[model samples]
Target: MGWFGDDSDEAEAYKQVMQRPQELSRWSNQLLGDAAAYEAGKAYEDHVAANGHPDEHHQAKEILAGVIGDFVDREVEVQGLDFIDRDWAKRHAQRRAEIELYDQHGDRW
Candidate 1:
């Protein structure tokens, strides 16, 4: 758990590595919930405004998450934080986007 490992396995000598989800957080900080998050939320809100809210808010959240996730991956690499897990970063970005959407739009979306 302390040391990190991808989804790989082999002989027992190396010891079975534990996949820690929490540790997957390489960018689950304000770096996500900050400016980029605002933009992502705004974009999703605009989408909802134009197309109307999805039948399920989770769908909108998923849309926001995907956009933020892409942004996170590109920005992390651009900022030279390649050690972070892209998927993990994306998941965190999604969470922030969902919160932002809720704060901005409330139950309307």
Candidate 2:
């Protein structure tokens, strides 16, 4: 078994992490519609362009905190794994941010 438990549990955890972006995107799209979503996405890109890409961990936490709320302690529990910590949050956020950036600018830059 892996650290989390059986392989199935690990897979479930991976699935949960992987689905975060879609969840966020759906939420944003429903709440703001396409035009606003595009604007929101551009904002993230602008932040990266102006301030440079955030440290992966910080970026994840920032996204999570923005989407949800401030993280208590250093971690937040999620599916499969014992908890979703800042590092995991960061990795997820980084992927989400990249997709958002791509959606906004495509291959233009």
Mark the regions of model 2 whose C-alpha exceeds 4 Å error after superposition. Answer: 1-83
Candidate 1 regions exceeding 4 Å error are 1-29, 83-88
* Local accuracy of candidate 2 as per-residue lDDT tens digits, 1-109: 1112223322344334335544432322112222222233445555666887556645633643453222211113332223334444444444444455444444444
Model 2 TM-score on a 0 to 1 scale: 0.29
Give each model's whole-structure lDDT.
0.52, 0.37
Error of 2 at 74 (Å): 9.0
- In model 1, the worst 10-residue window by lDDT is 9-18
lDDT of 1 by residue, 1-109 (tens): 1111222111111121112123334343444434345556556657766998778777877777766766666666565655656666556556655665676556665
**Cand. 2 Cα-lDDT:** 0.37
The numbered model that scores best in TM-score is 1
Candidate 1 residue 25 Cα shift, in angstroms, is 18
